[model samples]
Target chain A: MTINKTWLAGFVGIAALGLAAPALGQDKPDNLTIISHRVHQTVSTGEQGGDITKDWQDANGVGVEWVTLDTGALHERLFRELQLPETNIDIAFLLNTRAVDSVTKLLEPFDEHMAANPVENIDDIFPGLRAAMTFDGTLYGIPFRHASSCFHYNQRILDERGVAPPKTIEEMIEAARQLTFTRDDGTKVYGFLINGEGYANTVDLARAWDGDFITLDYHVATTDEGMMKAVTLLHDFYEEGILPSNWAAIKDEEVNNWMQTGRAAMSLNSCGRNRIFNDPEKSQEAGNIKTVAIPVSEAFKDKFDVAPAKVEFWTMVIPANAKHKDLAWDLVKTMVSPENTLKAALNGNGPVRASTYDSAEMKNQLPYADEEKAVLLVGRVPLPPFDNAAKASDIFVEELQAAVLGMKSPEDAMASVQKRVTPLLPQ
Target chain B: MGRRFIYLLMAAPVQVLLLAVIGMPAIYVLWLSLHKTAFGQVPEFVGLANYGFVLSDPYFWRAFVNTFVVVNIVVYVELGLAVLMATLFASGMPFRRLLISIVIAPYAVSEVIAVVIWKYMLEPDVGPVSAILASLGLPELAWTTDRWAAMTMVALLSIWLHLPFSFLILYSARIGLPKDLYESAATDGASAFDRFRYITVPLLMPAILVALMFRYVFAFRLFAEVWLLTGGGPARQTEVLATYLYRHAFRYQEFGVASAIGWLMVLATLLIASGYLRAMYKRMLTGDA
Candidate 1:
């Protein structure tokens, strides 16, 4: 009887052990899938796509699968996956425009994760960035890149016109006129370059003129007096031929080409694009490209302490249904650790932390570092997230283009925008 | 069991498969269209609201018109080019296989790659083709800003890429056509035009209609050409139904409206395709054309 009982106990122990083996394996998933744009994927990749995830993968004994998607598709996929109980996506990266209530509810809040596995110095991150990602005092995402709008221009063209970079919007207008010329090589240089149909940049330009399109609290100001003035100014710019004929259709890639080939004098683009314009192999006018703070509007020069600039940033979030949240947090820590943040900036990511710009190496190595830092302090995302935000943007772009293209008067266009967009705002 | 009952019993598995693959999705989309849906939000019943919005939206009509115009141009132009090439191929042309290979090359290339190639070639500022046009003192194509130019480019690219599909169908039919009919017409001193008009046209009508049915349906869903090339920009002037649906579905997250637009596309396609099906489908099934 004693021998039989001992044999039963041994059998029960073995059976229990067999059941728990798979559970133990489940604790450490073999792979964590992260999706972002190719450019933003460089964060896991070291400077210029060096392998930064090697140490993390080695430490965790799990592979990192990086999937790159365009900005539009990223938002779509993130939302779709989060709704599923079984999701392949462990981590996701999002732009500022995607931080609306619909998406935030689907994100795993970072309070518990931060308490257990802290980022190097959470306080060192920009207050605005933290605030933007926080909903009702719960953090949902960590800042990955903050690209501030900066003034970029052809130095050779400005020099040829015998004028320095314009400091005020009024001066820039005059400067653009003088700068427009035909080179000996028959290249027709426009004084200014812009994607006139783009709502983000158009709104940024309008905002600088004190034209408020929509306030963060869902206030509709498209028909405000300031916006009328902005429309008039832009229409006048288009009429004077300061902007290219294809300005209404030129997207970001064309803007790069226009500037790099020495075909345009000035543009306001995210500072990250500075690298593309200044790279010798990619640009014919590489060395001659210069960066500065966006010129202040004449109206707001005395009204504000700092110049107005537009800042749009991207962030990293773990989905609510993520299989390995703890592991994802660990990987996030490795990327945003104090030591790697500076390295990421050097590798061409827009640095999110204020301390990154303050570092001695950052100030020395990056040419536009000071300008970017200044812009970050003043700039905010051109449009904030709302339920109907994308629709609002489309409506604004339509009206803005109408005014610029002479289809409607600036007054009527702004009125039409206000009428159409106000309905999209939350009551 | 009766004959009809036995036929249904034998067809049950395939009917079930068709239901699983096609009918269920159509029903689900129909349900979705009846409600207002967005990400992470409970779907609320708003019967006919999405369709109402789509009908009232000016851009929807613009996209519909653009789809009609562009698809017709692509189908007609592609068919014209295919007929020309098929005739040339039948005439014992030199280096026929090389020319055939060259003609079919674009069909094999993926849509994204083809768009990228054309975008570079037609780029006004620095494209090789644009440069050639400039040297010859021709007016530059402002496709980026001009609505008509953008539409022209979209039609041109669609024809270039899908010409092969139409050409193969017509080419096969032309070869299969009775040689004795043409020989008899020639022996009777019929002109080449007369022979072609009477013998070739009457015989190839079935193939032509077949090509039209497939091309019209496929071309109506012309998303990539307009999406990649023009993005329906310069004030939504060049938008087609597919891109319009995409904007609502993906960009704005308005699934309800997107589903409604999708159903409208289906209805439009059916209305257009019903004509050709009624005329030629019986002949096609009987191999009598």
Candidate 2:
């Protein structure tokens, strides 16, 4: 049915009126608008909307406003708000992967703030996570939480197969080959499930395979031998049916679902996912799952003397154009303070503060605390900071998908990625 | 003159609304196209550099080609199918009301929801259709991975969701034709085919053109169906102009390039649409069948 003109007119009028009015908490002194995910709700003293801000205000004697968006839109929202400072969002909790490039253009350097008002136990933050929040030797953001890709496997499935947790890429592949089969009930169970849908997962595997697809200087090494091997290995898995036919379409949530429902014996998932697997309510494999360090690519095995896992972080930053930068830093300080970091850890966010891991409450709450802490020490950023990181990743993933689907050879795919990516990098 | 003034007064709100919604944005897009802007950076006036860059990019050109091809296919197929169904309905089929509702149901489903449903149904491993094919000892084709398969799937889904709108327009037009004309044709020794071709074809041309023009513009701006399905993937084979523009604007943060792409799309759409109108106008003037 067509929309009635009367109804349309009324709706538009109401919308215009609402837009004309100032938002509910815009005018108050010390009232800061923060953009972040609702995961911050986990750190709030009270339940529901603005509770974290209220709690922060009560504790620190300041007024604050909190707004949230999905993870996909957070970077775009933060970038837009920073560009248009009139939006009045003073602070943002953003992914560090995006923040690294955004810091110089959109965020204020916190070196001066750190010098003036040093956060207690700031040194206790994991070096990898702290490094992720820093750009060009100047700290741009404070670590809020960090997640690293790790090996999560169903122990019962492994035990039934009489296989050990894989420590190397070759061993993992062999185990996957052996464990993949259909059961008597005609249920198809796969051996390995990886979130191989995007660049992050591809980069994780590339790093493990010793493919220096990205250099320390933010140059694309897409055609590197190790990168080719990495792509080829994943393609081989797809070709051999060791992975599901729909592996190219699998995402993080599906990996979780596969692990939770025991459809897969092993999967490369995240520390945050381990929290879900350990929860009896959310997972059928609860108490039967185990977390191990991610297996390195056989080609790159020599480089991983310490056996590093892929690490990424979520951080809080003050925008350079923020009207109340100092207050924003104060809020950031409070949010990343040792006490609050511990609170975030307890909320199922991967702890960034080393001290938080030492807490008895953390030990009690996190079943994989030991594995996570160990991995954090060796966790590495798979892709370094660059201005065109997002675009570059998109190009890489497209080529990676082509290779995985046998649309292009590994060499050809990497060449395509390299050709596209070179133009995006700095001259 | 007084009545004209009253008409102007009546039209003022709509005129202003159109100006604000369409005219201003159209002008701003042209202005934005001349600048070099990325998210979080100050826009720099670059004087046609964005247009130069977009035009020179191979992927942009590919997207442009894909947009034209996919849109033309969807429009013609949908129009053909819609005209056939409308004619059948006008022929007095049984359960006409029920059939009409069933046809219109797809239109009621939101594009995003419909695309999601189609994506799941076509998914290779877990989808019921794929399972049934597998059970029949058929190969499980990777719908999103194969370029032609991906494009065809997106086009089919687009037609499925949008056919109802076109069908409804044509159906209404078909039913509105004078019944006495057909009676006269029958009396003149016209067969059913002859009656349709001689009477229905000429009369229904207006509705067909309208539906074609509407679907042309609509399909030309396709993004969600293809993007959600394959993300212009399997090596960007299914990428369309709109999705390409979105990549530049949002994902790549190149607002200037995106604006340039937007203006290009508008121009291309106008040229195609006007060509249709030009033919229709010539047909009208020439009294061509």
Candidate 3:
């Protein structure tokens, strides 16, 4: 009886071990998953092909997964996941400002990786993009996409009003006033709609004003007269009732929709605005839209030959705790290659590679390639890197919204932002 | 003996599920509240600093006040409307089932869908409601811009989302009330209003308290509706404590401060709930038990 019981116990123990094996195996991390803010549609479609993720996996020979979320959702998820030490995010793409503020500590600096496998002909990449991707003299990310601010106008509207797209700030304002009209129902249509609410747009507006958030040293708020002038210009539009009362709530898609629907004659948008105007399915007035350099201030014109056009870039980075950092970097390499960059640009992303922009295929696919090339030449990089960018932007956007909503004067709003943001700056 | 064993066997899974799902998480959250940690960072012992920070911050206090105001308005409005409707239904009014079903329809709609619908209607331009108001020759009121109006809008939306649940609870309580008391009150020449006030209200107090507690707690952490609508905008005027916690923890990535704020909120909630329970206990003991 004792011998029989011992054999039965051994059999039961072996069965238990067999069941536990799969659980142990499941707990081990295998595939690396990259989370980014770029939508799948932005990365793949039509001639670009919709299987970029599959292509990435095939090329890299790694078990990989890709997920795309919007910018805000991506930030929230990254922050939340990073709080848990066991999170499985192998790589992440963050807005430059967010990288600086939140994920800087979570990132593994890329200096070692860049040294190990330097891209051949690295100098061919845009200098501004390279600078934007560098933080504290170490590369934390690689620039994946970029856009510079430009004025997008409805050629049809301008022709109807017998006005040209303004070449200077004064002329732009004048044309805006002239284009304003009142319908029989008494609802007024704006000639221009400035994104007066958020810091994303205000950065471009600040460029026009020649204002720097961080001084030339990139360490403090400049608070120059030009920044104040930009703020004042926006305030004046709101005061004159030329701006929408819903301006505070307007998002990028809404702005694009408004411009495309002929609700506004001209608006300041990024270089990507060209893509929107050319999209046949999305734009109602597709063929009629044209791009030009944003009008310059007289003060800015003396210092800068062109309008204070700004260059901005989005980058991808691998997290410090990434289980598959090597694989993640490989994917980044593949996605950012000149060939893939051209594919991404064709699919609607602003390409970071100069060679891609200069390629015959890109020029053929993108109708306004020449106009874009002209605008790119004059574009200046925004003063500070994009990391922790949203914090400064949050303050600026709040102040702008406050001024636009008539809660505070432009001067007070600017002062408040300066006071709030100055303390957060690095000592 | 076999039947008893089978009964215990049947209940084992349910008991284990309760312990795993509810008891474990509740204990874990309590433990987390006691520690200081950043995202992807290990927790360090911080006895009560998080709680202290939350208590001292003016923003926390402001959010706390806003939460109370919103919760009070929503609860009182919903309770009043729900109890009246319940009483009407209990009175066997015409089309009572139809009225109840129609009233519960909004509650059946998910919070996200309800907020989305309301957002479109409240949009300053291109919204039919706004258009109608304009046609009435009224000044286009920035309903979402002003502080009081924004808070009211949130409360109104909360009330709409919660009306069906509140009504169902109170309606069932009304229907289940012992009929002998109503008959006795009528024999004593008690008017309909007097009977409802002296007897029906007293008898339904327990149910009302339960409904009030549910609405109050839910409103305190009201996130999605506020986030989707105003984004706590106009200078964070509409921001509640929960939204403030979320902004700090996620948006700003200030996990230390956020954790501290979170623990303090938990403490405040516990204290308020305890106080409520104590009062209810006192009332229960003092009343005709």
Candidate 4:
């Protein structure tokens, strides 16, 4: 099993020969490498990959390359590629979760780009969306997609159970309990389908229960009564068979599948998922899936009209080491153009531009446009975009899972989360 | 002395390359472990602070325990299965070509693909395996929610993906064993089990030790199985050393702490390898049957 000197020499020689020829990239005129997730590309350009560049090449004689990766890989790739000594990646799409303070340092701020050659209707983008792409009063990216959270339920189940749509946190729990039962086909449908594993599902629940896990100013609110109530209720629901038995382990993709296949009755999902949940081809509960603003907690009804839901967005940025900055800026301008904004919104993107919702066609086509607009007005960014925000989010979820799974008391779990996460957050 | 110097000279290129590729990075990481480092931030000399923090963290101990238990399950169980298969094949089993191909098929699959395939196959509600198990009225695998079940599932997967490696090695050793010893043992009226225990097993000792040594090292880095499947979850219950290192390095951006954990893993690996290495050396030196 050991390599002798002669054999090792031969292997090394061959490997050296192979490594001698590194790939030398050819830079062509007006050619740029753009990296993003597939849905982001599709929404911005109205095509998944090809022909968007083709049209641009035909019109402006400039070609673009799209490198699509999933969310985690996209963030990692962009982060690594931007810091490289030489990179061909002109523009990259960053998710809101990753658009933190340290990352903006590696990106080209658009303050100068906007001042010189601003995209049309620059002021039309929603405030929340604008906030996601900004750091220290400077814009580093243009918002492309902003999905606000919404409470989605199966209307058929509600009708069958003779329960009204929940308008408060307690009522929502009661309705979820009523919704949990066996259908005619003997399929056991859980009342709720929230992912107890992560910040996305439970953060909104914290707000609906009238508290926050962490605020924009780095405040840890885990010991707040509202936060305690949120965790306790989630635990109670799981124990009572309201939430799925595997709620602590359920993924975002699985939550979508549960709603589509009628395995679960309700979820705190993004407003954009309403389209997928009601797609006749993909969902059995099509047309029966209903959307509503997350209900405010009864105790805090006087403080707020409706529950505050967090918005996660995607924005386009130019890498600091980018070769073709002007072309990248042009592409970003084209993507954020008023016409393309409306087009992307129609193609299932959550519109970042407010004026897109003002169009009659947008209003007519997007049935929940007004509902989404209301959520958009009040939507809060999930975190403060701190250096270790992702790490903090991860710590919160670990404690939350422990709480939900009955391994720790809710108070103890939240206290643990607060203790562990506070050290990672900015003071 | 002249001939020895020539051999060293001939091996100089590869030795230097190994130093550059392996030794240098290890040294750099050791240096980083003493400082406080993160991406886009300057490393501040905080000598051993990261080590202290990581050592004190309960999750680190949890990861260590998970790695130990899961790896023991994978390596030992896989070694047992591999020996059984190698013996069966050596006994002139029927349809050897077809059976070997089927047995070794997992070796061709990439780790990511294997994880994806198993993730879907074991999904609780709709996966074919789950459906079949439910129809048979068997107890359901709550891999997603239950910590014990999740760890077991990861270990099971590691065994399946890696069994082919141990099996192939053992099979080669078994097939290469001299026929004369077994024949002579049979002529001396030794039973088949007696012959196997005395002749076959004694000869296969080297191969078995080698397989254990390699499998132990391979199984220790049980990252993808836990990460992709459970994400160290149902609250970091199935976390192993590799995932713990990854979470710190990538998610937390704590490069300094990650390096400390990485060095700790290297030390742990060396400790494991030393045991088998010493055994193999003893066998070689003593010429022990």
Candidate 5:
């Protein structure tokens, strides 16, 4: 009877041990899955596909499963996965503005994560980007590709016209008009190129003029008198032929072509696009491209105090359903380490860190690095978690385009957009 | 009883697949359309508020009209061109194989690739079409900005990509057509045109209906061309039902409204397709054209 009891005890112990083994195995994932739009360009193509990830794994003794998608599709996937109780996405890079909409729901607040896994140069990220990544006083993201807008121009054309870069909106208009010219062969050249069709397009100009398009409280500020003035100014530009004839339909890639081919003397484009202008293989007027801060409308600025430049950025966030938060955080830390972040800025899109602009390699690569950094100092992103921001943006852009297309007067368009957006704002 | 049981077992996998793939999603979409559900928020039963919003919205009406007009233009134009080409090919044109291969090339390329090519070709300054127009003293065509011009461009592209499919079906039907009817019509003092109008039209009705139905469904779901070329822009002039649905679902995160729009689209297609099916059934029952 004593021997039988001892055998029973041993059997129970073995059964308990068997049940715990699989649970222990699942405690750590072999590799983490990260999804982002630029993952392919930054990770796979950064150093011939697997070399970069392999090197990082070798150094840190970990592995990753990186997935790349287009920006629209990536967001769709993020939204779907976030709704699931168990998700495959361990980490993702989201637009900094989008993080506001997902904070504390789809994403885990990173204040604790950052504290537990301290990364060097975490404090060196640009203040605008850091603030943009924070929601309700909780940090939910780490800045990745934070870029600000700037006025880019063909320096050779400006020099030939004997006009310096414009410092005010009036000067910009005057310069653009003067720059429009016809050659001896009767080939007409455009003075300005504007991407008039995106969600962020005319809103920037309105914000510059009125100090706000939509207030932080989600009120309709686009119908303000000052904002209408900005709209009229753009309409005047269109009427005077200062902008391209197809300006009402132009998108971002067209602006790149116009600037690179030296057809447009000036353009308002993202500062990160400076890399394209600097690439000789891709640009026809590589050495002649230069950038400056977006000019302010002083008449409007005199009435309200706000930043002159508009900005937008992207950030990395860990999902709430992530299986390996520590490993994901460690990967983020390693990827954004001082040395790797610099490498990322050089290879991929914009840099997130202030030190990146100040680096020797960045200076060598980007001729207008200082101007880009200066723009960041005064740049402002539209505060997000604005109730239904995407919908509001679409409504505003549609009306703005109607004004641009001469279908409606500027005042009418602004009023129409305001009326439509009023009900959408948070009560 | 044993045979019946074996038959049910044999069909079980397919029924399960149909349930998982189609039945569940359709039911889910119906459920979603009746509720006001935002991402991260619990669904609230709204009882057709979404459908009401879709029906009342001016943008939805605009998109519906645009989809109807664009789909009709694409399908009819594609059908006419395919019939003409197929008739010619069947009547013994030189290098018929090569001509057919060339007509089918656009279908081989992916939609995105085809759109990219067309986008470059339509560019105002650098595209060859623009240069030719410039040389001819014509204004640069605002293919994307002008409402009618953008719609025409999209229709033209749709016809090009789908022409091959229509052509192949009609051509095969033409080849399978009985030759004795033509010979008898000729013997009775019928011209080529008469023979074609009487016999070929009646016999090819079946194929034509098939081609039209297929093309109508494909053209109704037009997204890639408009998205890549104009992005439903320049004041939403070229917005179609599919792109509109896409914006509400993906961009705006309003899946409930999108589902409502989607069901409306399905209903519209069903109503149109019902006419064709009824006609087809009549033709089958009467054994007439």
Candidate 6:
């Protein structure tokens, strides 16, 4: 039903007033605002945020205020506000997926920013990281944090069992079998546990078998024999009762708990988990945990001729409607500056820059720095550079999980996934 | 005329709020459903394409079937238990007040907390429930791994969550029954079971129908509990429409397809609700006439 013009005008007037009230009180330029999703401790702690904000104020001669939120919440907020012509966000810290998906439309390209700040030493950043931040030959993000999947095992358990950490897929399975036991109470203990419910889990398992869900050409690639092998290998873990029956519900934190309690002998976890082991308050198995590259199948070993390391990176980007785009770039430059990047690396939770890794500070901080470096060299990141990595991963993982649970055979699960995902892949 | 104008003036605010909050979004979603859009791209007009795509999708059909199965299981179980408990309470059992309070306690806990509590209880190694089963010499079951078992576990949780509301409504309806009917039934040599079947059951049907409708809707939209508990895993065997739509819209960012699926869900819910309302209306009219 159409309303009278007078009533509509009155309603519009009230909304206008409501919208105008917030804008009336702002002295816009004196303050630099940065909207970031790194609300958790390694990024925005009392020490970290305070130090960064103080340094930013010194560098830019402005009163800088930082607003922090979790990743998902920040995306919702930024997506809404940035749709408007003038967003208040000067800078944003988002993950690689969001940056790639939303950057061209929702964010301004960072090439101009980098070009203007040539003295920022952007070249010194790792090439893999730089490539990760670029989409369609234009820079969209600056790398901030890097992660890789590594096998975190209990040294005490392995030593007691007279077994060494597995370096190949077959050895890993044998070790997993050896570690499993059933108690008199009929409670079955596991040797290895990984998330079997989602795409990330499948991708982790697929890496060992050299399977790719989507190939570099961006086609559905899960119907291959290698993918089947990967699915079967994971299924065998469950079929043999070497992995927890509740692996589908298992989360990263739960995996950490299993390792810390010495309940599981091994888990494929992010390298950042090392910090948890080093923290006396959090870890029961501190000083007894060792990290190594994930085991590879014989075929993958021959193909890459090295142990496969699964590399993951986190990036920060500015939204298109950011009020202070220049200021945001300044913040990005400062945060990723060699000195600060090195500080973050030494603190055990930042991106791996070439300079940061070779620095004496990092060496002093990480006890296993040499071993970590060796593993990092051979790390393999997921390919195809699709914006739907998270969703694709979820589907892949769920399908693999079906195989693991014996609901579907490896071939059947992969075939089903191919049918579903093929249509969604970018041409 | 002046009085009518005043009434219009008074109602305009609510009408405008409803239009802005509900009507506009519904229209927007409908518009979106008829388009084609991929991640990081502008939408293009594609009349009926998304609907066609959704209709042909196996995942959509699977999720639709799963939703119905879950709804049916949860509703029937919850209704039976709720009616029984209400009758026992209506019979003036001892500690009626305490029993009523205890029966309604599960409603106080949020769905997430309920799922989390159950998850721990059903854990393979440390869960007390699994331990109990093992002690009883029963084969240890992976509650979230086996497809049928996972669906059953989710249905069980759904019923558990809806039980308190169903019981409260049925109990109130039972309490409201005419005292003379029960007296007449007892005097007529009606057995306890006969009294329940003849008097209590008939009287509670209205409340039961309402309770059933509410439970059906709640069980149909089940997402958080399922997501946190199983994440629709073991190969999407436990996936319902809501979780499937979520994966499409947010995770896949296929907004057009997601919107189409959403409209399909709305249509399905409407059809189910209409059937329910019609059945209840017919029952009510026939019983009264």
Task: Report the number of the highest-DockQ candidate.
Answer: 5
Writing each residue's lDDT as its tens digit, candidate 6 over B1-289 gives 9999999999999999999999999999999999877644578999999999989988889888988988898899999999998888887899988888888888998999999888888887788988899899987666666767888888888888779988888888888999899899899999999998888887777788888888777777889877888888766777889999998887777889899998998888888888778768978877751
List the per-model TM-score of the A chain: 0.91, 0.85, 0.81, 0.86, 0.88, 0.84
Of 1 and 6, the candidate ranking higher by DockQ: 1
Off by over 4 Å in 2: A1-30, A45-56, A84-87, A100-105, A185-187, A223-226, A260-262, A275-288, A297-306, B1-13, B135-138, B279-289
lDDT of 5 by residue, B1-289 (tens): 9999999999999999999999999989999999887767678899989999999999999888888999999999999999888888988999988898999998899989988888777777567878888899998778756887888889988999989999999999999999898889999999988987998888999989888887777788899988877788878888999999999988787879999998999899988888888787778677766
* TM-score for each candidate, following the candidate numbering: 0.88, 0.89, 0.83, 0.86, 0.88, 0.88
Candidate 6 residue lDDT tens string, A1-427:
3568878998999999899866643423677666665542355334532354467776566776677787777776767676777877776666655654454467778888877874267777666667766667888878777677767777887887788878787788788888788656754557787755545545655767767677656777687765677678778887888877788778777877777767787877776677786466887788788876677787677765334555667766777867667766776788788777765664456545666667776777666565555556655466546666666677777777777878788888888888877766665
Whichever of 4 and 5 has more DockQ, that candidate is 5
CAPRI tier for the interface of model 1: acceptable
Give the alpha carbon lDDT tens digit for every residue of A1-427 in model 1.
Answer: 9999999999999899899878776668888899998876675576553566778899889999998998877777788888888687888998888898888998999999999989988888777777778877899999888878787888998998897888777787788888888778766788887766577666556666655678766677777765676678778877887776656667788889889988889987887778889999999998898988776787787764335567788888999998788889888878887667787887777888888998888887788898888777767677667778888888788777778878788888888888888888877
How much does each candidate deviate at the interface, measured as C-alpha RMSD after superposition? 2.4, 2.4, 3.5, 2.5, 2.5, 2.6
RMSD of candidates 1 onward, in order: 3.8, 9.7, 7.2, 10.5, 3.9, 7.8
lDDT of 5 by residue, A66-124 (tens): 78899878876887788888787888988765764544467888888777878786878
Ranking by lDDT: 4, 1, 2, 5, 6, 3
lDDT of 4 at B175: 94
Better by lDDT, candidate 4 or 3: 4
Query: What level of docking quality does candidate 2 show?
Result: acceptable
Off by over 4 Å in 6: A1-28, A40-50, A167-170, A183-187, A205-211, A215-229, A277-286, A295-306, A346-348, A415-423, B1-17, B37-41, B279-289
By TM-score, the best candidate is: 2
TM-score of decoy 2? 0.89
Give the residue spans of candidate 3 off by over 4 A.
Answer: A1-33, A37-64, A67-92, A101-116, A194-197, A273-288, A302-312, A319-331, A374-390, B1-36, B40-47, B178-189, B282-289
lDDT of 4 at B159: 89
**TM-score, chain B, each candidate:** 0.95, 0.91, 0.84, 0.96, 0.93, 0.91
DockQ of each: 0.44, 0.35, 0.23, 0.33, 0.45, 0.43
Clashes per candidate, residues 3 or more apart or on different chains: 2, 1, 13, 0, 0, 4
Listed for each candidate, the true contacts retained, as a fraction, are 0.50, 0.56, 0.32, 0.56, 0.54, 0.70
The true-versus-predicted C-alpha distance at residue A261 of model 2, in Å, is: 4.3
Candidate topping lDDT: 4
